[model samples]
Target: MESHERIQAACDFLLQSPPGEINDVLNDVRNIISDDELLQEGIVPALKRYNLAQFITVDVPETNHQSIISEAARLSTGSEDEESQERWLDPRSKKSFVFDHIALEASDPQPFEPNEDFETFRVALEKASLNYLLAHFHDGVSSAFSNQTTPNQFILQVVANKYNPTNFWSGRWRSEYIVDLNDHTIKGTILVNVHYYEQGNVQLSTTHSISIALPPAIVTASPESAGTKILALIETEEGKYQNSLNDTYHEMSEKTFKSLRRALPMTRSKLDWEKVLGYKLGAELSSSKGAFTSGFS
Candidate 1:
């Protein structure tokens, strides 16, 4: 496949995986940018864009290569340029030679001090860094999703209420599961819910119940797994645009979806959905990890 397609696939895969799997992401990056352009253009540019090159400090002073090349070619076919600008060897490989030049240029590199205010340069650098990091982060996320090795299940729940006695209300539900390939262990799940209002007066509403159960291994692994399971159960049953009892709800929960759009490095950082639900239901778990109940007053 083309580079863009490969990148896209990797991203879709990462949505199901974790970002901490760096090796897998790097491999996917290699596939997206082959050896020819990968090193010079793709990898180099990506690193620079992400400010990694700055951190690595790849700059150094120029070296006099005239005598070194002359000595190496005492009886060889290689020739040195007048000022040794064109080609030179220092017992380092050809790649190292290029690397040295890049480092030299980067080291003490000229800053864009075009008589602008201090904040200007700071803002520009921040924007550029953000752009590069975002692109690389996206690619990394995709690669992580594709390398998932866990098995999972999804469950959804929908709940709705109407204040008036005669009006109709709607609710939508959705859920997703990332399944592990090895040992059929569940990795994670994303859940969503939505509520819609109608014009007429109505009171009382129905709730669609859903229950998802992961294997014992997955449930006991970490809190993230537990959160994913809870999300799946709630998302499976959301509100329908309109309910005639037998009618299907094509719409899924979309509210607050973007709030959780940020990516985490691993499943262990997944939100504690149990605490959230517990607070919602007002359960009396005093000893619970009530992180989710802090500001819900």
Candidate 2:
């Protein structure tokens, strides 16, 4: 086994190297650490695991042939006619070169300088909301989901962020409980946006903004209880909307039927349904009955 000091020295050298010398540092690391140890310590295992052969390499060209004696003497004497200028190697002259690193257009890496600000009270509610769903909410067919990313990067945020979460790339019915954390017994609008698009131009989506006050004992309640309560609140809001929509549809149907019955557009008169119903009822009742029950035939 290698000594601890030896490993420490090697690691220090690697960490000390500048970005320009990273490739050379990697080589040095390989030489200092045996292949087996390298694999154990996660140095070379990446290459083996991926079955990788090709790699990006910085330019390391061979030295050019020596210039003629006259040319060498002139360079040693230095040029006096023109000012000195920076020189650069032309990539086209080289045998081969790698393409520059690939990057998507308009893509910006996430910033880390501003240490993630965790809203203590807000996060508590968010966690509680998630927990409540996990512990208590159970739909026989549909399942619930919370943001699987880091706690700092959840869908529920204290303030609106400039972002466009592309949810339509995936197609399916999904119910996610996202918190809108706030400081109150009454929480902010929890979101249940059911969105999806499929082939054949079929699509469906709806955003359910639910608001509710937590139980006095929610803080004392278990996470599961809290999340479940959140879900319950969402369901309650949905139920209210469902009833409202149904009532509206009923009213609309009644109004439409009345308008239809009032008069025909071209004929401007209602059908004589009294006489028609009278004939229909008389015929229908005596359709298969005897003379005793058949009246006014």
Candidate 3:
């Protein structure tokens, strides 16, 4: 079947059984357009809608993580313009976040133990990354997180579905690194993606990739020593995005949202909150009693 048709069918399947497990839903998409390059184009939105709105996270298959690396490989090879790359590569666009490149270089590449060395490096980095991610992105709220380490890259994703029983707010975070394993030296990019949904109140989402340069001897360093440096790297990037989220959230809640709940400005200027609330509340409440008391009582 065609890609759009498959996507539509997947959407229909979701609407029919919205509570289907994330893996199951993704598997269904995988069956349909598994060969198409636009695999994420269909699966991502379907998964986002289904996972963000309907269900808490489940065991996301390791294939899901590897697919990201595969996508990175595709993006690197494709000759598409930067804009197209961003549109397809970005997990979300609500915040217009962009990705930065990460390049790992080596002065003297050496042949080392293959799988074992990669595994050691991957485990050390993942262990440190998960800890930092929880500290920075999670804000102490309990979230479902996954870190996948491969010979080529590492991916860490976090999903938070709990809200004030309203199901109005949902969020997910993902970070991935795509690396080129060249004997001893490696090269690649690391990216962080965040998506937040607030029904009626806000929807703030973006995936920004920041460029990071890996140490030349990263693959050769001792696991402990490598982890320490990688920990510092994760700390730097996660810290940057943490600040971005904070600032954007403030802008959204403090400025952009006023139009949704506050009185319209008639003179093309900001509305006087004091006067608007006073007049609106005064007309509805007995001025002799506190508005809260009168309304609740």
Best by lDDT: 3
Tell me which residue pairs clash in candidate 2. 132-226, 132-227, 132-228, 133-227, 133-228
lDDT string for model 3 (120-205, tens) is 55556556655664666543211211113344454333332323325534344444444333433322233322223344434444
Clashes of each: 41, 5, 3
In model 3, state the lDDT of residue 103: 13
Q: What is the lDDT of candidate 3?
A: 0.44
* Residue-level lDDT tens digits of model 1 in 1-297: 776565545444433222123235556656655654533343433432222211112222243221111211112124433222232222111111322222323122111211122223223322332343254222111001112121232111111111221333332222222333234443332222222336543222333333334566545544444444433332333223224333432222233433556654476476677687866666555534475467563
Q: Which stretches of candidate 1 lie over 4 Å from their true place?
A: 7-28, 31-35, 38-40, 52-54, 59-297
What Cα-based lDDT does every candidate model obtain? 0.31, 0.36, 0.44
The whole-model C-alpha lDDT of candidate 1 against the native structure comes to 0.31
TM-score of each: 0.17, 0.28, 0.45
Q: Which 10 consecutive residues of model 1 have the lowest summed lDDT? A: 139-148
Colliding pairs, model 3:
99-209, 100-209, 101-211
- lDDT score, candidate 1, position 160: 17
